[model samples]
Target: MPELEVSYKTTSKQFLGRVTTSKESADFIRGLFNEGEIELQEQFIVLYLNQANKIIGYYKHSKGSINATVADIRIVLGTALKCLATSIVVSHNHPSGNLHPSAADKVLTENLKQSAALMNIKLLDHVIITKDGQTSFADEGLLGIKTYDQHTAFVQKVTEALEQKTKHNKLSLEKLAQTFGITDKTEVKELTELAIIKTARILAHSAGNVKERFDKIVELYHAQVNLSHRTSQSILLQQYSTPAPIGYLAGIFCEVDKLKEKGGYAFEPSAGNGLLTIAGEPERFYVNELDNFRNQNLKTQGFANVWNRDATQAFFDVQGNFNAVITNPPFGTAEKKVMYDTYSIKPLEHVMALRALDCMAQDGKAAIIIGGHTNWDDKGRIQAGKNRIFFNYLYSRYHVCDVININGAKLYSRQGTSFDVRLILINGRKLKPEGAASLFNPLKDVEVKTFDELFNRVMDAMDAVTNNTFMKPTNTLEREAIELQKLFTTTELISRFDNPPPQEGLGEALNPPYQPACESSVVLNTQVPDSMAFETRTAIQSIKEAVGGDIDNFVRHRLKYPNK
Candidate 1:
């Protein structure tokens, strides 16, 4: 009998296409399905791609009943290996017209992702398709992974540039001081400060306006840092910066922009790069950030005063001076407990809130984002422990106006974690004796499961409140909040996959075409091509030896430097 021969062939003379976004991937996959079968039966399809994300081919893995399908991981990996594909996008169509992934869908996706990693293949995204629309696991952050993209790349580049400039300026300043034989520490410090200011101005001008520059710098801090190191640091410090939408919402409640227009003073305790202050657009603002890097960033933004002291100390000299205080303070307990008179407020968020209140003028308004659990449980009842003491203290002393519960999953998806947060809008003025007595009786918290639910509860609370000049009119505030919600939701949903609008003169380089270093060619008679055979063999050997049989490291190495 003749030896059996296996060969790979392609019908197309050119590449099918390259997919960069979840929407594009969905569209390409949808076009491959049989229109008649798509609505009648569930089908699992996988698209194999080269390192550049250019589609190599697609395989219909399995087909089953209307609502479910069985997908074999071996078959999927086998096809990818045959195609020499580096990445895969798995998608399935739902006959029920629901874009949401079922429990089984999520399980299958996780399994496939892990399996692909073992084989040195990237599972880029898992999409659910319906006639109406598509849902991407990557876009929704369901994959529980972070992939490097243009935004991260840009931030990394900016960080490198900044570091180089800083080093050069420092060396030059030292050389100048040596040449002049100058030993005055104050003079050297002043000169260094001037250099930093000049460098910041240059970066600010190149990046764009205050908001744009602030965002870029924040991204630089998050992206350029090592993930594990940063995670450890963050946990120790309880440092989670406010998302832009949350910052804007806090600003709206605090009326930051209006205060800015009136030349009112604002204070932000535990300001992370002054994002909250930027949202308020306050002309006169004082900020305190414990992190040295973040404090330097605040200075770069040209804030009136950027203090690097413990915020619990309450800016003693400037106490009772601020018109507005807007902040998202560090959550969890402080390393050293803070005392409120004889009472101990162990929760760092509460300490910061109390400090903010102290820093505010008698009529100052504040919107503080704190851990939601501090006020109520999931069932809307007050929680036990230190929370009760903190709430009682707050209600008995300050004018507690309204609390808006924000869904952390929707807000912090990019950060790859979720927790509930509450934005408490407060007045610095002490509550009237009768009002304080009534509020201190018992706390009635509203149970909220969704954004809409929490929004309605907030609106109702606003309606019940009387004679509060800090809050805008009910109709106006409602309309503005609704608009902001719409904008925020739209921005979050589409931001993951959408390409930034092209800038003038940058042209195609802004969104470069996918180009693989080694062109994929047909394999015949189980023979590997000489061009890729050496690299492939070496990569496999390196994976087996150096990485202890971990394919993920090898695959990432190849993808990072494709030409090698």
Candidate 2:
């Protein structure tokens, strides 16, 4: 077993002189500092006084630059307690000869008072000393501490009285402040303005017309004793935040003609305030929004078939088919795998595309906007691998009608960050299961410098689709042509065509143009020339490393395509 001991001691000395009033306190504080010390820089000092108002001990808490010095409330309270002080007086000097108490001075005095009270110590005064004179927060009655609840209630009562009277017959703000026991002019104005703004926002939601709402809000403000309101006002304000520019919405709707008919059932799976769905104005529309506030907004706007639920869950259980589905789902969210077990589609954009397909009519079409990672490169060429698996799957199932690259400026709100935007247009008709999908560069012919230009090109394309004059899907044929053209344009092909080998030692004189199938150790056949043997061996070594050595099989490939 171990033994423990505790000890206590008091080494502080006693002090004697009483400081009852603000002037006597200020004079004692001023007398402590010499004229030379006061002229150097700003300094904060605390004077610990006893129950009889006698000075016990004093501490210079901080020394700062010519303009200001920092004083920590903790240091002040600790020093008072250490010195056995019952009351304390704090002071600081301003080198600029100004004796007015700053806004920070008033706040600091209130905080010190509150903290000292907690320790069972009284705060006598806070004085600002200057070259000219001194000012005391105690003398001005600014040191009286009031709780936040008391101030807020007073302001609300005054605001209610003002709302009940006409503009010409209203009570003066100064008189109202005096009646409410609030002395500071700045606080009176600030609290009044805050109360007025609170009323305006609540009434803004109740009525539509400007003058009518203002009049009605005044009537309600006067009749009510208290108003229940949202603690966080920004939540209501952010509901009005614009998600995307109207021009981008217009551009999406420009493809209306591409649908099986001009008008039919439409749906927005991730409807945020129903902006796109409401703007598109399909004959019949449905919406799904995860946010409860936005769902209520959609309902207030006369959208009845709105489902406030997670998109993934709601989409999984969706009942009816949509003729046209348009959506811009949340990006950068983790998507869980459901319904399809074979495919490992993880990105939210890719998952939304697959889910959108599930709820579409057999002949339905869709326009989707995806994030930057799928569409852009530094050199501005289509890198084509980010969403290659998803795109290939689409081509295998449905016809990918068009692809467009929307400039960042046209896709987001004015205050939003710039990002790369990609749109994919799909035709609901299914393709044969056996063949691969074709890829084409539709953006090559379209000018997307401005929203208008982009919208016009989409409209023209939709017109062609509706008139049955759309371009045929020759994507596979175009890709084959491009490959053959590249082969003919190679430098090695040109060199081989211009020069021929001697027929006498045809096999021995000619170096194999292609790589070998294997690179296992073996002696070279002496019949082959030295110059051609070095190049042939090197090519064979590379091929064997890549495909595992099959020498005879590699030779047959070279013979099959002699020029290549």
Candidates' lDDT values, in order?
Answer: 0.61, 0.55
- Across residues 128-244, which tens digit of lDDT does each residue of candidate 1 receive? 998768998977778887432222222333334445643333344445544444344333333333333333333333546544554443443333211121356667666766654
Flag regions of model 1 displaced more than 4 Å. 1-229, 374-381, 431-564
In the range 1-564, model 2's lDDT, one tens digit per residue, is 899654323346555465545566667777877867776788998888764356777788899998878999987887777667767889998888788888888888889999999998877678888755788776666778443323445555655654654331123654566665676654554355344433443453344543354345445333432212122332322212122232133224433323324656677777665544433432256777776545533442333266766666536565438777777766544556553434466666677767777787777767676655344332222345536556666655665565666665543423133445566676665645422333333334242555445555555556655764433454443433333324334424324332423234333223223222334435353343322433455565566667545655566586884522
RMSD of 1: 36.9
TM values, all candidates: 0.41, 0.42
Q: Give the worst 10-residue stretch by lDDT in candidate 2.
A: 238-247
